[model samples]
Target: MKKTAYITGGSKGIGLGIAEALLKEGVSVAITARTQNDLVETEKHLKTIGDAEVLIIKSDVRNLADEEKAIQQVVDKWGGLDFCIANAGVGRFSPIDEMSAEDWNSVIDINLTGVFNTVKAAIPALKKSKGYIFTISSLAGTNFFENGAAYNASKFGVVGFSQAIMLDLRPYDIKVTTIMPGSVATYFNGHTPTDADAWKIQPEDIGQMVVDLIRMNPRTLPSKVEVRPSVPPSARK
Candidate 1:
């Protein structure tokens, strides 16, 4: 049987890119997102890739039950999950002075708590397969900046959470990795990905990195990876 992966936020952006790469490697993939419409569109697009199995579940990762249901469905379809990528996240930029409690809560709930839910749901199956758990954090996790208070807090929390889980699951032979990526050319935070953003990282770059991590020997586990554009426009400017 082909190895199976579950990706949250797989409807678009980096999550979708990872799914594409994994499918090309002949892995069965299951993705979860909030909208059925978006999930349908993603499923349709993934069909063009070949005969790889694709599962789409409409889920709001903020809900623990929904996360569990999504995982159960994948297990039922694929027999087991070999990888779980917690990529469901959202960001809203505003300085602390202007950031509302609701915005901060929303960011924390989805990005951090949602990951907790995803990991918890996948833990049992992962333990059985000695599977990998990958979290999509950001440079904001470690670097502070203005107008990014909520996003930064959530990502920082994610980094901490991911590392702690790494320790918790190490004895089980389950690998945990946190990927902290800098600016990427994606339709994120109101910025449309454009050719001009060529100097920035691309979603596919992150996806390829995931594949590389998977191919690594089990004796060596890279617990954290920090990725940024080799030539960031911010530095050039």
Candidate 2:
């Protein structure tokens, strides 16, 4: 039987790349985002990629009800979900003293609580299918720097949450893996990708990694993975 997957924030960046990869592998996919326009455009682009079914859902990860609805829509359309990717996130960079309460809340709500909502909504279906869960974290989850208070706290919480859930879900044969990537060339944090980003890790590279993980033998599980550009700009002469 053809597998099905659900991806959050799938309109662009890492989510879109993962959707493309899964579609190429003949997995029917459902992608969610907050904007209807982006979802519609992404659906059109995905259709051109392969014959796999693409369902675009307008959803905000910060809302548990929205996430639950998104998951139900996928299951209603595709029967069962074999994978869930919690990739919706945002960055708010500022020192604690300088950060607004609104900015801090937005970052935590979307980045950390969002993951909770996505997984909570999908757990039942995943348990039944013995499926996989992929949470996107960052190197900043572990390494903190200046002006990164809110972003760091959210990602660090993601790492801890993902690990704990990995153990909790493994009992049901549900695989949970957290991927921490550094310097991906994507339109994240208001930065547009350019030729200069050629040296960084491409979003598709992370997508390919997901494909590999799905194809791995069931007996082995790589619970946590950290990926970085092999050579960063700082390393260049």
Candidate 3:
């Protein structure tokens, strides 16, 4: 049977790349974003890639109800979900003293709580299918920097949460993995990707990794993975 996957924040960046990869592998994918226009455009783009079914859901990960509804829609259309990627996230960079309460809350709500909501909503279906869960974290989840208070906290929470859930879900044969990637070339944090980004890890690289993980033998589980570009700009002469 063909597998079905759902990705949060799937309109662009890493989410879009994962959707494309899965579609190529004949896995029906449902992508969710907060904007209907972006979702519609993504659906059109994904359709051109392969014949696999693509569903675009307009949802905000911060809302548990929205996530629950999105999961139901995918289940209704695809019968069962084999994979769920909690890739929805945001970055708010500022020193604690300089950060606004609103900015801090927005980062935590979307990056950390959002993962909780997505996984919570998808748990039942995944348990039934003995499926997989992928949570996107970052190197910053472990390494802190100046002006990264809010972003660091949220990502750190994600790492911890993902690990704990991995253990919790394992009893049901649900696989959970946390992918921590460094410096991907994506339109994240208001930065535009350019030719200069050629040295960085591409979003599709992460997508391909997901494909490989899913294809691995059921007896082996790589619970945590950290990915980095073989060479960074700083290493260049």
Candidate 4:
């Protein structure tokens, strides 16, 4: 039987990277996003990844109902889930004084509470399948910086929430890992990926890690992963 994965924000960047990687492993992937355009393009590229099925789901992770709908569609289509990657998030950089209520709430809603909704929605299915959960955090989860108040708060929340749930879910054999990645060359932060960004981590690099994590011995779990570009920006210059 083929493994199955549900990836929120799978239309682009890190989520898309993981979806492609899992597809090549023969895993059926259900990818969800709020935008239909991106999902359509991503599903097309995903089909070229390998001979696995791609389920396109138009969803907003911030909404619990939408998340539950995505999970149910996956279960109805593929039987059950083997993994859930909560990768939907956004970042806004500004000093605390300059940040708007909308900025803070949007970030926290999608980045932190969004994961809460995704995990809760997937729990029943995950327990049934003895599944894995991957939460895409950031280096900011542990590190702080100026103009990063909202982004930092959300990511920090992700690390804490994921670990707590890890403890709660072990008895059911559901593995949870929060992935904190440093500087990646992607459309994240509104920056277009380019050749000059080669020094940074690639989305595919993160994808490979997800595949490796799920392949680990069922007896062991590396619940937290912090990945960074081996070459620092100063060194890259």
Candidate 5:
């Protein structure tokens, strides 16, 4: 049977990398985000990777209704869902005193509550198929820093929320994992990957990691994975 996967924030960067890798392996994957242009571009790129097994969905993780609809569409088209990846996230880096209410809420809404909505929306189909879930958290989730208060809080919540859900869903034979990546070269925070960023982890590395996790033995569950660049820019210099 052909397995199906749903991914949030799948238009670019790590999400797109994962989608491309899965599609290449013949996984019917659906990716959702709010940007129409990015979705169009990603879908086109993915088509070159495989057949027309990729679906582009315009959705915002902050809205439960949107997530529910996106999941339903994939399930309807694919017969079932075997994987759900909560990778949509945003970062607002400002000191506690300088951040506004909107800044805090935006980060929390997309990075924290967003994961809640993604997994919650997929549970029914996931329960039926004994699916696997991957939460794209950050190393900042565990380590704290100045000028990163909002981002840190949201990622920390992601780490905690996913850990708790792993327990909740384990009884149903559903596997949950949180991926805390360190310094990946991607388009996060409006920055593009370039030659200068070569020392950081590549999005494709994380993509391959997801495939490896899903391919692991059914009896084994690696619920948390932390991936970092083998060498930092400073060390490489």
Candidate 6:
């Protein structure tokens, strides 16, 4: 039987890439985003790929109610969830002195609290499947940079939260992994990915990594993965 995977922010970017990768491997996958039209369109595109079952739920991770609804819908349709990718996130960078409290709250709500809601809603199902949970963090989670205070704090919290959950869920046989990727070529920060940006990691690269992690031996848990471009811009320049 095909295992089921659920992902947030799955309308595009790393989340969508992971969905595509798992679909190719014949896994039933559900994807959620904040827009219904986008979810419908993504569902259509995914159907053309393989026979994997696809469920599209329009959800804003910032809303706990929306997250619960999406999770319940996936569980109802797929029977159980074997994997979850809490990949929905946003970034708004400015000097800490200039950053508004609203911006900080929104980022924390969506990035950190949203992840908490996703995992909490899915835990019972994940526990049943002896599943895996993944958080799409960033290098910023570990290496702080200027103007990244809010974004860094949220991701850093993700790393810590996921690690804690890894220990909490071990007795239940569920695996947890945190994927910290550096400069992926995705439509983030209002920047669109282009062919010229082949030097950066592709969303599909992260997707492939997720698949590999899922397939690893149950006894071997690579709890944290830090991936970076083999050759960075400074090295090339």
**TM-score to true structure, per model:** 0.97, 0.99, 0.99, 0.98, 0.97, 0.98
- Model 3 ranges with Cα > 4 A deviation: none
lDDT of 6 by residue, 32-128 (tens): 9888998998898999878889988888888778888888898888788899999999999999999999999988998999999999888989889
Q: Which residue pairs clash within candidate 2?
A: none
What digit string (tens of lDDT, one per residue) describes model 3 on residues 144-216?
A: 8999999999999999999999999999999999999999999999999999999899989999999999999
194: Cα error in model 2, Å: 0.7
lDDT of 5: 0.92
Candidate 1 regions off by >4 Å?
A: none
In model 5, the clashing pairs are none
lDDT of 4 by residue, 1-237 (tens): 289999999998999889988998999999999999999988888888788899999989889999999899999998999999999999999999999999999999999999999999999999999999999999999999999999999999999999999999999999999999999988987999989899899999999999998888888888999999998778755
Cα RMSD of all models vs. native, in order, equals: 1.2, 0.8, 0.8, 1.0, 1.1, 1.0
lDDT of each residue in 1-237, candidate 2, tens digit only? 289999999999999999999999999999999999999998999999878899999999999999999999999998989999999999989888999999999999999999999999999999999999999999999999999999999999999999999999899999999999999999999999999999999989999999999999999999889999998979978
lDDT of 4 at 203: 90
lDDT of 5 by residue, 126-231 (tens): 9999999999999999999999999999999999999999999999999999999999889999998899898888889899999999888999988888888887
Give RMSD (Å) of candidate 4 vs. truth.
Answer: 1.0
Show pairs that collide, candidate 3.
none
Clashes of 3: 0
Tens-digit per-residue lDDT, 36-131, candidate 1: 999999999997885789999999989999999999999899899999999999998888888899999999999999999999999999999999
Off by over 4 Å in 2: none
Give the range where candidate 5 is weakest over 10 consecutive residues by summed lDDT: 228-237
Candidate 6 Cα deviation (angstroms), residue 27? 0.6
By summed lDDT, which 10 consecutive residues of candidate 4 come out lowest? 228-237
Full-model lDDT, candidate 3: 0.95
Model 3 Cα shift for residue 213 (angstroms): 0.5
* Clash number by candidate, in order: 0, 0, 0, 0, 0, 0
